[model samples]
Target: MMGGNLTGTVRLTRLALRRDRIQLPLWILGTTVLSSTSYTAVREQFPTEADRVTALRTAVDAPAILMLRNAPTGTSDGDMMAFQILAFLAVLAGFMSTLAVVRHTRQNEETGRSELIGSMVVGRHASLTAAMIVTAGANLVLAALLALALIGNGLPAAGSVAFGLGVGAAGLTFAAIAAVAAQVSQGARAANGIAAAAIGAAYLVRGLGDAFGEVQPDGYTMTSAWPSWLSPIGWTTLVQPFAGNRWAVLVLPAVFFAALLGTAFALADRRDIGMGMLAARPGPARAAAGLLSPLGLAWRLQRGTLFGWAVAIGLFGVTIGSLAGTVEDAFAGNEGAARTIRELGGGGALSDAFFTAMLAMVGAMAAGYVVQAMLRLRSEEAGGRVEPVLATATGRLRWLGGHLVVAAFGAVALLLLAGVSAGLVAGLGNGDLGDRLVDLGAAALVQAAPALIMIGYVVLLFGLAPRLTVALAWLGYAVSLVFGQLGELLNLPQAVRDVSPFSHVPALPSADVTATPLVLLGVVAVALGAAGLILFRRRDLAL
Candidate 1:
C-alpha cells in the first residue's frame, strides 16, 4: 500500500469539494475567461501571414521579448499566435496547480486539519493521493475548457489539443513537485513557501533559457544548466501547438511527473504522520521588536514581498532602460520597424512612445505587490490571528496605518527604483547618465501617486469586504491593464479606458507634467486609503 494513503480519502474528497466549491470554481472560471479573451485578442492582432512574419522578425531580434516569450519556431504564423501568451499562461497553470496541491497537503497540515484527518483510519498515502487526484482532476477540466475555448475560436483542432495537453501536463508535473515538497516540510506554511519558491524558480529558469537558448556562449556543456528542459514552461513551447504541434514533447512532462510521483510516495513511506523527514525548530515564543503592533505584524508578514517587488521592478527598469539606445537606433535606421514599434505606441516618435509604453507597463506590474500586501491585513484578521493583537492596547487605526505605511511607501519606492534603473541604463546607452536618470526617475514617480491610489483601493476592499477583496481588487488591476495597454490597440470604448487612473496619466516623456491630473489622482489615493482605515476601525474583527 502507498504510504500516507488513507481510506478516508473519499470523505476528504467530498469535504474538500465542499470547502472549495466557490473558490476553486472561481479560479477555473477566471482562467477559462482569460484564455478565451487572449485567444480572441491574439487572433485579431495577427490574422495574416504578413503580420505574423513581421511579429516573428521583431520578436526574434529582440532579446527582451524572447526573454519574456519563448522564441518563435519560424513555423506557421497561426501556430505562432500561441507564443504571445504561452509563457504567462503556462506559469499561471503551474502556479495554480502547485497552490492547490500545497493547500491540501502542507497548508492543511499547518492548520492542523490534516492532523485531524490523520487520526482517522487514513492510510499512509491516501490524503496525498486524494489531493493529487482532485488537483489533477481540476487540471483536466482546465485542459478541456482551454482546448474548447481555443478550438471554438477557430484554432486548428490538433493544435488546440496539444495546447490543452501542455497546460494539463504542466499542472500535473507541479502537483507531483508539491507532493514531494509536502513530505519535506514540517508545516504547511513552509511547504507552501517552498512550493511557491519552486514555481518562481521554474519561471526564472525558463526566462534564462529562453533568453540564451539552452546552449552556453563558451559551451562547456553544463548538464545542470538544463533549466530549459527542467521547466514545464519551456517544455510547453516545445509542443509548438499552433504551428507544427510537436506532440511527443508533451510526454516529457508526463514522464517527469511520474518520476516525481514515485519519489513522493517513497518519501511519504519514510516520514511519520504530520511530520517531515526533516526536523523543524520551534518558532520563538517571545515577540520581536518588529512584531509589536498590527501594522508591524503586517510588515513582518509582508516584508519579503516588498523586497521582492523592489528587486523585480528595478530589474525591469534596467531592461526597459537598456533598450532605450536600441529604440533610437531603430528610429533612425528602419522606418517600417519604427512604425510597428510606434504602432505598439508614441503615435509617431519611436523612442518617446516606447518609453511611455514601457513606463506604463512597469508601473502597472508594480501593483502585483501592492494588492497582495494590502490584502494581507484582511487575511490575518479573517484567519483569527488579528483578534489577539486587537485585544491588546492596539488601536484599529494605528494597526491599519502600519500596513498602509508599507503599501504606500513600497509603491513609491518601486516606481522610483524602476524609473531610475531604466533611465540610468537608457541614458548611459545614449551617453548621458545623469540627465537620463533624472528624467526617467521624475516620470516614474509622476505616475506613482495614482498607482498608490489603486493600491489604496485594494486595502480598502480588504477592510470593507474581506471575502470579495482579493478577486475584486485583482479584477480592477486587470481592467486597468487592459485600458492602459490595449485600449487603443483594440479600439475599446472611451468610457472603458477612462475607468483606469493610468489612462489619465499623460505620456510624460512627450508631454510636460500637468498639475491638475496629478493632484486629482493623488487626492483619490488619499481618500481611498483614509476610507479603508476608517472602515477597518469601524468593522468587527473576525473571531
Candidate 2:
C-alpha cells in the first residue's frame, strides 16, 4: 500500500525536471555566480590579512551592519567572504526551493493538472513526491556548483563544501515547509505567500539575533543571540562556512527538513484531492458592485499583496530610520568606523549616507512588488481565468491596463510609505520632523521612476512571451539588483553596471538630486508599457 502511494513518482520527477530545465539552471547558476563574485570582490577590497581583520572588527562593533549581514567568526579571507555573503545566499536558496516546491505541487493542483495525472495510474502522493525530489535535486546541484565555484576561486575545499552544504540545507528546509504550506492553503497564491512569509520571518529573526549578538574577547568575532537558532537561515550561518567549518550545525536544518516533510506527507494523506486542510471561506452569494469592472477586480486581486508589501517595507523603513540619528554617534570618535560606513554607503554626512543607502535598498525592493503584481497576468492566463473574463464585454487591452494601473500606483504608494515611515522615525529621533519628513519623502518618491521601468519591462515580457514571463521577469530584477547595488563592491566596470536601470537613479540625500536620469527612465518606462499594451491587444490569450 505504501509503495502504491508513491507509484510513478520517478517518472513524475523526470517530467518536473523537464518542465523546470530553464528555471532550475537559472536559479542555480545565478546563485553560484553571485557567491563566487562576492568572494573575488572581497579579496580585491581587503587585499591583506590586516585589512580583513580591521573589517571584522568594524562589523562586530556595528549593530546595524550585523542586522543586515552575518557575524564574522574569523579574520581569514574565506571567513570574511562567508561573513559578507552567506546570509543573503541562504535567503536566495530558500526562495529558490520554496518557489519550485509550490509551483510543482499546489500550482499543478490549482490548474487541474494533478487531478488529470492522478486519474491515470499515478499515486496519490506522486505529484508532491516528485516536486520534492526535483526541488531537492536542484538544491543539491546548486550546492555542488557553488562549492566548485568557490574552490576554483582559491578557497579551501573544506570551507567551500561547508558553504555549499549550509546553503543547500536551508533550501531543503524551506522546500519542506512549502510542501506543508501547499497542503494547508486553498490556492497556489496563498501557499506561495505563506512560504514566502516564512522566508521573510526567518530572515527577520536571524537579523534580530545577529543585531543583539555579543562581541567576543578577541574583538573580531561575535556570538549570535538565541533567536538565531530558531531560524534555518541562522542555522546555515552557524555552520560558519569558512570560519569554524562547524559541519555539525548542518544537522539542525536536516532535522527540520525531516520533521516538515513527514508533516507534509501526513497532511497529504488526510486531505482530499483538490482541497486544503485550511478550507477557503465562502464568498457572498451576490457579487459586490466593485466586482463589476476590470479595475475593481484588479484592485480586489492586488490589494492584499500590496498591503502586505506596504507593511513590511514601512516597518523596515522605520527600523532603519530610527537608527539614523545615532549613526554618527555610534562611530563618532573612530575614524576607521566612519570610513567603513562611508565605504558602505559612499561619502557624505554619516546619517545622510546611511539614509541614502537604506532608501536605495528600499527602492530595489519596491521593484520586486511590481514584478509580483504584473506576474498575476500570467497566473490568470495560465489558470484559464483570463479566457472567461475576455469573453465578456471586457477588451484585452482594458484588462491588461487595469492590472498595470494597480501595479504602477501600488509601486509609488509603497515607495512613498517607506519614505514617510523612515523619515517620520528619523525626524522624531533627531527633533527635526518637518524637514526630515519632506526630504525623505521626496527621496523615496524618486525611487519610483526606476521601479516603473521594471514594471514596464515585465509587462513587456508578459506580452511578448507569456510562457517565459514569470522566470524572465524575476531574472531581470535579480540582474538589476546585482549590478546596480553591488557593482561598486564587485569592481564591475561602468559599462557593465549601466545594464541595471537602478544604476542611473540618483542616490538621494547623500548626493545632490538630479532630474535628467529620472526623466529618461520615465520615458523608457512609458515606451515599454505602450509597446506591451499594443502587443497584448493583438496577441492571442495564452490559454
Candidate 3:
C-alpha cells in the first residue's frame, strides 16, 4: 500500500507544477537575472582589486550600507558581489517560498480545491505534503540556476555553490514557516499576512544585528549581540559563501526548517479541514455603527493591512535615516566613493542623493500595497462576497470606488510616513530638524506620483482584463523594480530604463524639481483611473 497519509502526493505534486508552470518559470528567471546581473555589474564597476578594496572599506564603515548589505569578506569581486546582493537574494528567495507555499496550501483550501482532491485517492496529508515537495523542488531548482549562473559568470564554483545553497536553505526555512502559518490562520489572506510578517521580522532582525555588528581586522564579522542567531536570514550571512564558506552555519537553517515542518504537520493533524489551529471567533451580533457604508466596510477590511504596511515602512525609513550620519562620516574622506555617490545621487549632496534613493525604494514598496488593495475587489468578487454587497443599494462604481480611494490615499499616507520618519531621524541626528523634515517629506511626496501611476496601470488591467490582473500587475511591478533599482548599476539601455515610471521622476534634492514630468504623470494617472472605472462599470464581473 502507498504511504497512508501521503498516498497521492506525487500526483498532486505534478498537478501543482502544471498549475504553476508560468509562475514558477517567472520566479526562477527573475531570481537568476537579478543574481547574475548584480555580479556582472559589481565586477564591472570595480575592475581592479584596489578599487574593490576601497569600495569595500567605504561600504563596511557605512552603517546604512551594512544594514542593507552584508559586510565584505575580502577585496575579491566575488566577495564584494556577495556582500552587495546576498542579503537581497536571500530575502527574495524567502518571499518566493512563502508565496509558493501559501498559494498551494492555504489558497487551494480556500478555493475548495483541496477538498475536491481529498475526496479522491488523496490522503489527509497529501495536499500539504505535495505543496512542500513542489516548493522545495522549486527552491532546489533556483539554487542550481543561481550556482550555474554565478559559476558561468566566472565566480569560483565552490563559493557559488555555497551561496546558491544558502539562498535555497533560506527559501526552505521560510516555506516551512509559511506552512506553519497556514495551519494557524483560517483564511488564506491571514496566512499570507502572518507569513509575510514573519519574513519582515526576519529581515529586520538581521538588519538590526548587521547594523550594529563589527567587522574585525581578521575578516570575521560579528553581530552586536546574539539576535542575529534568531533569524534565518541572518544565518545566511554567517554562511559567508565567498569569504570562508562556513558550512557549519548551514546546519542552523536546516534544523530550523525540520522543526518548523514537524510543528506544521503536527498542527495540521490537529485542525479540521477548512479550519485553522486557532479557532475563528465570532464577531459582534450587530454590525458596528461605522459599518453602515461601503467606505466603512472597505476601511474595515483594509485597515489592518494599512497599519501593518505603515509601521513596517516607517521603521524602514527610520533605519535608513539613522544610518545617514554614518554614511556621511564613512564617505567624507574617500574620493572614489564620494565621486560614485555624487554620480548616483544625480549631482547633489550625497545625503540628498541617499534620501532620494531611499524615498524611491519606499515608493516602490508602497506601490505593491496599492496594487494589492486594488485587487481586493477581484478577490471579493471571486469569493462571492462582492455580489451580496452589490445587491444592496451600493452600486458597482461605489463599491469599486471605495477600494480605489483607499488604495490611492493609503499609498500617499505610507509615503508620507516613510518620508517624515526618515527626515525626523536624520534631522535629529544632524541638528536640523525643521529644514530636513520639510525637504525629505517633499521628496517622499514626489515619489508618490510614480506609485500612483503604477496603481493606475493596475486599475487599467483590472478593468480591461480582469483575469490577467494579478499576473500582469505583478509582472509590471517586477519590471519597474529591476529598472528603477538596478538599471544604472546594470548599465541598461536608457530607452529600456525609461519604461519605468520612476525614470520620469526628478531625482529630488539632487536634481532641480521640474513640474512638467510630474504634471504629465498626474494627468496620466487620473486619465487611466477614470478609464478603468468606466470600463469596469461596463464589463461583467469576472465572478
Best by lDDT: 2
- Model 1, which residues run further than 4 Å from truth? 1-4, 74-77, 177-201, 204-230, 261-295, 330-332, 345-349, 447-454, 464-505, 514-535, 538-540
lDDT of 2 by residue, 1-543 (tens): 989999999999999999899998999998998897888888889998888878888887777677678888887778887888898888889988988898899888878888789888998888999999999998999899999998998889999999999999999999999999999997777887788789889988998898889889988899989999999999999999887889989989988999999999999999997799999888899988988899999999999999999989999889888888788888887677777677666668888777877888789878988988888888888788998898999999888888999999999999999999999989998899998998889888889987899889987898898877877887788788888877886778899899889888776777788889999999999998888888888788874
lDDT, candidate 3, 1-543, per-residue tens: 337888888899999898788877887789889888888788788898777766766665555556667766776767877887887788878877887788788877776777788889887788888889989999999999999998999889889999999899999999999999999998777886787678778877887777677777744343434667788888887788877988999999999999999999889889888899888888889999877788888888898889989988998899878977876777788766666666656768888877877777787778878877776776677556887898889998888778878888899999889889998999999999998888888888888887788778888888898855655676787778778666886767799788888788888767889999999999988888889888988998764
In order of lDDT, best first, we have: 2, 3, 1
TM-score of 3: 0.91
lDDT of candidate 3 at residue 363, scale 0 to 100: 79
Q: What is the lDDT of residue 292 in candidate 1?
A: 73
Best by TM-score: 2
Q: Report the CA-based lDDT of candidate 2 relative to the real structure.
A: 0.87
Better of 1 and 3 by TM-score: 3
lDDT value, residue 184 of candidate 1: 90
